[model samples]
Target chain A: MGKYRPGRRALTGATIVAAASLGLAACSSSGSDDSPSDGASAAGGSDVELRLAWWGSDSRHSATQEVIDAFEEANSGITVVGEFSDWGGYWDKLATATAGGNAPDVIQMDQLYLASYAEREVLSNLADYSALDMSHLGDSVLGMGQVDGAQYAMPISTTSFTLLVNQDVLDELGLTLPDTDAWTWDELGEFASSVTEASSGDVVGIGPMNNEYSLQLWARQHGEALFTDGNVSISEDGLASYFQLALDWAQSGAGAPADQYSEQAALTLDQSDFATGKQAMSFTQSTQIAAYTTASNGANLVPVKIPTEDANATPYAYLKPGMYWSLSSQSKHPEEAAQLIDFLVNDPAATSIIGTERGLPANPDTVEQLSGNLSPEETKAVEYTETLDPILGDAPEIVPNGASDTDPLIQRYLLEVMFEQSSPADAAASFISELQSSIDAA
Target chain B: MSLKELNALAANRSARRRSGGKADTRDNRAALGFLSPWMLGIVGITLGPLLYSLYLSFTNYNLLQSPSWVGLDNYERMFGDERLHQALKVTFTYVIVSVPLQLAVALGLALALDRGMRGLAFYRSAFYLPSLLGGSVAIAVLWRLVFGASGLFNVILGLIGIESSQSWISNPDTALWTIILLHVWTFGSPMVIFLAGLRQIPRAYYEAAATDGANVWWRFRHITMPLLTPIVFFNVVLAIINSFSNFTQAYVVSGGTGGPADSTLFYTLYLYQEGFGNFRMGYAAAMAWLLVLIIGAVTAINFWLSKRWVHYDD
Candidate 1:
């Protein structure tokens, strides 16, 4: 009887533990109902503590943290707590927090979600942010933060899709560097093949992740927009050409072997075989170039423009803001937050401290103020931009509502093709059908 | 009978009854007091949101806009969605292979460590440490590095005169298996449970079997096997539940794509990608409910089967 009593007690104990565990996990996993986005506040002059959330690598985190510290030091009344994570978990955590009504006061907004967040009314409109004299900022960069005639976020520094080359690999093959301004794919492919042949199995010619976005640069250079008004705009032949180039590189031992494509399919620019010197070339953004340069011995790296499909093809390089910062509508201190953003964007001291870390400064005045303090690599990148004369495209259209969800569906098809299991014909068909179905459902 | 004897007997009976009733009341109050935090938590948090999600599972919830009731529309869509089918296939394969393999290895390890060895705690802790970090971001990242095409594993093979081009985690044929191996490697938690079960068996049973001239194998077959059945059942149930719901490892290892054509797409990862990544919260809610049902049914089946085989010695 006594034993049975203890067992009954144990069951009660187990129930308690289970309930508590569930509560804690639930709280951790979801957004707070009390989050300020919808505008409810407990009565108090109690000093406000706001969380500022972002995703970045260590350097960005540290630099942003320093800037936050400066903001706090200058504005003694408000305390800002920063919440950060790497890219993989950032959105999940952010969404969970947002749902729970515990969203951060200031959010680092990706272009992909800027429109979605705005449409959902989760983001505060920044119509008055323009009043801060951001006219000094690059209009091209600022354009990305605008969606449907409303500004939901302020433009941060800007970057463009660019290419990185291994100069040592080029030299080893007795090949001169391709002219950044006038290079074509046939010229580059021949150079790539020569480099691969000379490396004697030590290096491959190129390594691109199985991403449609990476191919968009070349597609854009041919004056083909990857998507237009909810439809894929690139021709079937264009996709075939893109895949064929990748297949040719693989077959010629100038790129990752077919079996190894999966390994490289999902890599960030940092872990790319090119960055680690396992390959000769990689396509990425100017922001990502910093990672590749820092990861490799500096002597062999060079920033170059992505080549055009043909001689007459435009050297299309879309320069746009990498991300944006926005004050939440729920924030009681929007005025103060706006002031901090202005300081971060246009102040000479903050610009110098931040440098091109966020990318090139979006503020034209800040760019002018900070140019003297730019690192050699950053300066080289800025100089390389002028030489490419890239045909600037419009800011990627606000990734349409639910398009963020559908982007990976497209990538999956591309990956299947790249790994040699599927033809581009089958891949494109499946991708278009799948995405269309999803879009229709949405 | 004498008056004193009669008085003593009456007093003893009354004392016994009073004590029993008092203990019952005390236990009732104490149990409620101890459970106050949990009762509050469940009503305020778990039960509240779980019921809300149950409502959402039936709705057309985009999460950005308020959820609208859609009467099984989400469930209906799931059957037609190829991604959901693919996710189910991947998740089932992961659970079916990883759970049993993990238990088998854990049981083998527990048997090996049953001997009271020197520095036992150190060995136990060393073996158990991976379980602590089994779901961590670092381990997932390490999994990528070790299984990468030009990684330490391939480099080691090259040193031993073997040519290999296997990027195990990224290879569609092999990515799922790499994740299974990672799941199996964290068998320490179950091993510890098995160790506690081992200590509960009476030494006399083995001794008596030995006196019957039974060898070590026979003794173990008769003694240890039956004695550990309950714990084995417990571990199997727990492991299957844990394995079926794995997310972080797959999420991180696959770079949140669940790629190589969704080969490493565990069920929970798919749910998360749908819910959070795609913002198909209603569809994701449906997936989550399905997971709960599947896990619950499997566990119930396990318990029913355990009644036949799990010997709990009195």
Candidate 2:
């Protein structure tokens, strides 16, 4: 202990990098001492402990646990250990676990990170697991979980992005939505103005929609993509105006003031401007309509298609998975994990327990079966997506490898533009360049 | 008597040497046994990861895949990365502004407490409370709520007929200042140290100066200031280093986005965002090592400056 051996220390230091990486590679080889146990469980009908992880609220957790209990009861040879966290902590924990070679068997995946994980080969090919029944899920829905034309994950539920209008807010202000079915950004702005003026500035019309999804829709409405063919294709000027929309609203008193809007960015869903009746409309995933309704004390929120300025553009809206069930490539029990996923998606027992909690069912038959069981808001959310199916846009290629950073990247520039720290053109240029570099680096 | 003591010490040194020193050998083994737990932690837990991260700095190591060597690419990117520069600017401003202000508040409080006042212990503990919690996520969250729009600060301003709805923590121009204020609020640790240093100053110095018709200001300037120089220097160096590495307060206040246009992006938080948020572990590792170098250089500068102002009895 007292002796100094710099050479030995350096040698050990070098081996650590090798050894640490070797540990990850070794996880796949199944050569570690614990592999025998993991392998035996996978290879045989021996009782297997399949660890499932997800992120959700308390209601979702209780429902998921209830379903897990039913699944365990049905499958005698398997016991599922369900671990859950809030949304923010879930990804970090998953990444850390995957890196440490201790990832769960089944993971609730988000579309934003699906490609990132799949491209990195952390997720198993869904095709390899034959027990999972996904035939009822159409190609468009399945494509959302695909990378390089191969399914790497399964969509748990389908959700579409929509602009939600608070009918109650409009009713209180003694105003009406102006033919919202096929509105433009100008119409959106005008409607917001009418609400603000009608309410004497007590209730702003819309909260900030300068986020990634809003920008994506805006780009698609112009027949482009912020991410095109694995690159950011939107020009700086186009990007500028997208950000400038929120700033215009902020200045025109159609949206919350700059400070208030930015502060509201940090708030939880229930405390958001729309939820608090401070904004007449806001953008959200259709799946969140139920959550918003609950948060706003049943505001009678209605989902409206995203607005477009150009008459010639294609449908800019697409259904995204509420979350996906992905099998970890490092899982010792891939078959059992697939079985669980199939059960969760297909079994009436599981569906009845989970009833639109994860979102409306991803499969057509399951949706039909659960239509009667859905909560009032869930039925509306499901019905809204169903009505828009014919007009939904072509699914985007699974987002690029580094596209998971879209939210924070877009958010930073959104704030910069709104605060006038940088002109919209400059902010757009910076954002595009930054996003491009990240994509290229990835 | 001194000659005998010197002989005894020499004989003891000889006995402690490695010539048939069985007792000393046993003592060494016992010493090693005592240190084994800590030694294992230092090597396996600390050094292993430390060296791994150093190696990772030179590689493209995303957590999803094994790292491949990228040489100086990550390090080279730092010079061109504008966001890194902003993070550096924020960190430098925070350390520069907050440390001096915090030390001043701590010193003032320490001096105030130095007087033999009623319930000195109570005041000391009360002042020290914030230091214990200042870096905690809970207090940082509370800080966010307190400075948010329509928060207590704005509500208080309204009471005085000065209406404001500005969210101090969300505005980029004022965001870093709120964090600086959070840093300054944790003056207790330095205050306690200053209190101890104040006690070390002999009361006789003040008495002697007073007898010579020195006023309170003169006594404080001549007797107290010189004696407190070492403590002041210590606090300055520590505060600078601590504030430079500050993360929790900014992280919590910014909601982990470092936002309102990246104003509150501490270097550590930026590194975390790069490493975990974007999966740019290699770049993040390089950033972390750079932070170490930056903190090292700053501390060295502080030590160098200390030579000019530090007063020691020797």
Candidate 3:
């Protein structure tokens, strides 16, 4: 018995040591899979492979992959790999990758984050890449990507903040569409209230308008910028008016109750009040009109100019980049990256594959070429954008660092005012102070 | 009781001890070999990151830039940050309210299920299902749908003529409560533990109390309560620790913003937002360490207080 005990112990010890080593080996094997290719790509060679990353829906993924395939075919020596994720997880993954010094060669950029990444030197300066073409892109649109006179990103497409109206709901209520071209904010509010009164609450006239983008447009209509000179520049009075209009609309029975309004504010695009056929009008960017239309099951969704305080004054509507494509500063093959970006923007065959998924193409020639194949909704977006071309104001300055962090504060303050938890004046003051402090901290 | 028996026991113990010396070394080697996987994981994955985070807490380490030492700046910044305070308040309120309510439900259900009855296994498994799914993202999404403005809860309230028009999950005043209820609904694990504790109590004790003329309430108070204290204490400690770190439900329900006026911002969720959303990893590390300290202090207090009420069979 004693001899067997010692033998069993020896066997167990040997088995356990073998198992431990195997476990560690399993972990190391999984980690090393990506390092070889990653190391090879970082060592820049004539035969270069690039990692391109973006965030979008399944359709966008397939189309972008097609574009990548075309780019790889055109430049036989360069291979491009696609890394994509949904918008929700994209930023977190990008931040981790960038921190690890393994960022993709090309990244999809957003205006809200352009300054932050550019200032950190995580993005490469596009002006250094002579292979990239920019003459076809408008200066105003391209300027959105510039920080301190260096172009760090190039705009791929543009979207304008517009009012989306569910015309089916309006028609069901026997109400004619209000003339948005000359409508004032008060006029819009009254028309909305009338629709709600006519429908007897089966439908709300409008959903809440408390988002930062809508507030920015509201401030812009009053000749105020959301941010200027690296600080929040919207006046307290301007903010108060902005909140007060939504409050008045809520009180007048044009908008959802404060509780439902807040709920709708937090909903996804497909679940919004207008998309669910519970509201006649909602504010959205032109790029969102298609999603709203699809959600409403082919309802007659129309986009119109946002109402202004004075229609004769400088137009408040501005063309904003849907997103930008920028090269990473860590890329080993910046020239190859530049060639890919140029191909995406200038090659008609590639743009055709991209279609209107990113938004209307930023290039006028690409827009014209893609116009012939647009879906009805896409065509409507194109026509809507062109109509505003004659009167659109200059785009606001690039959003400052830490600006995205202010979104929750804005939502909180908006709800506080709407629910009468705080006065509009007080909410405005608090928002301004908090926003400035956040920006200052950044 | 007898000196002879006592001496025999001592001799047996010494004989075993002498032999154990040699076997002990061999046993330890085998045991450590078996434990190597977990030890390696702890050292490489857990402890490595934990110590790195402690070092990072003293620096200004935004993800994109190299960390620069800032001494206590990250900790100092917490004093003036209202959002940090709000997150703390929300987390404490949630933990304070949730842990007790969840244990009560767990203990109550456990007592009821402890009786030897037909289909007991079926009922046990059925009740345990929710706890299995409680921390999942799908459950969090279901929670949002259940408490949405035009959701099942409000729909039922309307049917009952309660006249509630508010979205329970989005309203600042009640959003946290919905999440607390989600925590309470997942009381199955503690219930199962309490069941085991209840079964450990001798059935003869209850019969003796009955013969001594104790009523149902009296029997429960005298026989059950004292005997179940250890399990209750175990459940309370675990529930408090789990509640303090609640994140997935709040993150999914709040859409990762801890929104509707930040009413549902758990501490860990706020830490994630700072680390990932704002890219302030140093500040997030500081917050993470603060949470560890807070949990440790609370647990120490619990252990100290347990002596007054907790009872052991021996």
Candidate 4:
């Protein structure tokens, strides 16, 4: 065969050279921005530029912007630069920034990324930010932000993957709401089926998102979790049960069919069958309700506690401190940066504007101050959560370093089982074995 | 002659020679200077990463950790990795099935349109448009809508009383074919190439064959077939490369899982899952190298076989 034309080859060659230069530049810039100086002391609260980055939905974006503006106005010496993106792109951007060592001064970290970040030494230990006082934050919320023995970031608020109910749907279908606080899997299935049948297919009872929330809930219920130090904690039986529910729903048409799911998956939640009023209930986090509510425009939504199998098998939800405000280990103005973070999380005015946009406030004082100001739905969610507070389980170890990579693998096996190509037992066994090995190697 | 007169004559001759050669030499050097930038890039950029990746393929280097020398272990591991096998099987099946079917349809459409149709350019552009956007996320998303249970496809099927399984995307058996059909639908590029090749075929050859009482089928078999062989060969090679590298559509449609029992688990998607998603960069690098070798070997075979069928008019 003839060789590639010289002109085309040369163009390709030049393009590669340019790309390499850009990559090298990106990698090198981080080192210069982060890391401590050899002899210079931390900068005073002068005209310091502090970069703050976070990921959130539109509501969080607006509220956070307002908080940032108030913080900047109150602290004239500090310049807070904000960067934000949706959840999907946030991690990839953070990882690359961490690798470069030029991470943001005040970063928003989730439990999913906290351990990995701490392990990689990308975040400054917030315990070192001596200027900021966090004595007022709740232990349950503050506890998650700690890595190893040292605190790396301050938890802003505590959130969980709670279930949102359409109370109107239940009322219309003439079915009483299941005891979500400690309902078993069998009870949930029956309730959903009855609702669907009674409505003549006008409503599909529940839309279970085959995501981390479901897996986490299922894992905890079975007396295990997704990860234990270096290996999987959930038993094969637990995984089989998880896949079985998803499959049974699809098979019985209690949820969207598999083919329909594949197609509907192409669209976002806003364009999904549920959003279009074809489905009644959906499993989601309390934070996600803001978007659903705005889209549904108050369609009789209610936040329910995650259903559990029994008292012994009580569902243990996570208080994801709505991510954390972390300092880059390489900042020149570490003190001022810490001050900026202190204002964002602890200051009353900033908290008021931010409201529960982050989540139910982790600060007891802030929660108390905003009690009467909350929307009816927000008040209900907060009350529901407080009632279930005593049942809250201990937080697991920070998500393992390779934790982010396992979702697709889990989804693959789950999909296989859903389509009946692989039996639940076999898929569960294969998934656990393969994923453990993969995580261990990583 | 005087000594001064002799020196002046020698200096004049040397100055004249220098002036004459300088312009020509400078022109030659200028041409080389323009070309050197490109030549340097080939060695430093293109070949540099190429060789570095090859070296990395033999090591255990995750993006976070330092690379450890592992000899051929990384490559050897591919033989045992179940996901790798599945991805390769899916990728090869896609290439083998989709490429030929797409090319045939493209050629057929090109031939049909060559019959002096009105607004031919409009039709050609309309047909060519899908190829430009076939691999994009939007199309992948649209593909989901068209084939979803509540999708347009199901609605159409329902009208005719043909009930379909709701798990189109979730069904392993049909997921791969759905992707294949999408690949086939983007026949615009190859069709345009075929049309171009058909135009280059001499009209006189067809007339001469007609004079020999050759029917349309015979004329096409003898005249059109041999002449279009070069384009056919080009299309096949290109299709194989493209199908092997297919990522965006599958990634978007499947949410990067390549799911439904791994039926749509393309090689690149699997590699991404292993590397970025799983943080198994070392394994991913090894997988990438294996894919290169496979694609290289397949292309080599295609070249070897082309001598038998590919013909050039020149």
Give per-residue CA lDDT, model 1, range A251-325, as digits (tens).
Answer: 777676765766765665566578677788877666655556766756467777777656465546666567788
DockQ for each numbered candidate: 0.37, 0.26, 0.26, 0.23
Interface RMSD of each: 4.8, 11.8, 10.0, 8.4
Candidate 2 residues lying further than 4 Å off, grouped into runs, are A1-45, B1-22
By lDDT, is 2 or 4 better? 2
lDDT of 3 by residue, B1-314 (tens): 89999999899878877888776687789999999999998788666677788899999888898888999999999998888999999999999999999999998888888888889999999999999999899999999989997789988999998987678998889999999999999999989988987887778888988999999999999989987787677677777777887888999888887877677888888898888778799999899888877877887787678779876554
TM-score of chain A of each: 0.82, 0.85, 0.84, 0.83
> Each candidate's lDDT (Cα)?
0.73, 0.82, 0.82, 0.73
TM-score of chain B of 4: 0.88
lDDT, candidate 1, residue A324? 85
- Model 4 agreement with the true structure over A1-442: per-residue lDDT tens digits: 1132123344334434433443232112122345422223246524667778898766777888888889889877666778898665676666656545566778888776676667656678887777787889766667778878778878887776776777767787788886676676667777777778888877787765577656877788778888777567889999998888888987776765555555544345566566666677787767666666655666777777666766665547665566677877767678888888888877889887877777777788888888878876667667766776767776666666656656556666766776677888999899888867666665
Runs of candidate 4 with Cα error greater than 4 angstroms are A1-51, A76-81, A100-103, A138-140, A179-182, A262-269, A272-274, A312-322, A330-336, B1-28, B40-45, B65-68, B158-167
- What is the RMSD, in Å, between candidate 2 and the native fold over all Cα? 6.8
For candidate 2, the lDDT comes to: 0.82
Please state the Cα-based DockQ of model 1 relative to the true two-chain complex: 0.37
Q: Give the candidates in order of TM-score, highest first.
A: 2, 3, 4, 1
**The candidate that achieves the highest TM-score relative to the unseen native structure:** 2
Summarize candidate 2's per-residue lDDT along A1-442 as a digit string, tens digits.
1122123334334334433332222111121223224533555559788889999766678889999999999988888989898766678778878877888999999878888899999999988888998888888788778889889989888777888999999998889888866678888988898899999988989977755667777777777787778888988878888889989998888887777888876667778889889989999888788778878988899998777775456777776667899999999889999999999989999998888878877888888898777887788888888778656787666568887888878888888888899999999898888988888898
Candidate 3: tens digits of C-alpha lDDT, residues A1-442 = 1231223344334434433343223122112124316425344455788999998756677889999999988887788999998665788778878887888999999887788888888999998999999999878888888988899999999988788888888898899977888788788888888888998987888866766677778888888899998889999999998878778888889888777887755456667778889899988778777667777889998998877777788777778888999999989889989999999888998998887778888999998898789888888888899889766887788788877666567777888888787788998998999888767766
Checking candidate 4 for backbone clashes, the offending pairs are A34-A330, A35-A330, A258-B167, A259-B166, A259-B167, A259-B168, A260-B149, A405-B277
- Comparing 1 with 4 on lDDT, the higher-scoring candidate is 4
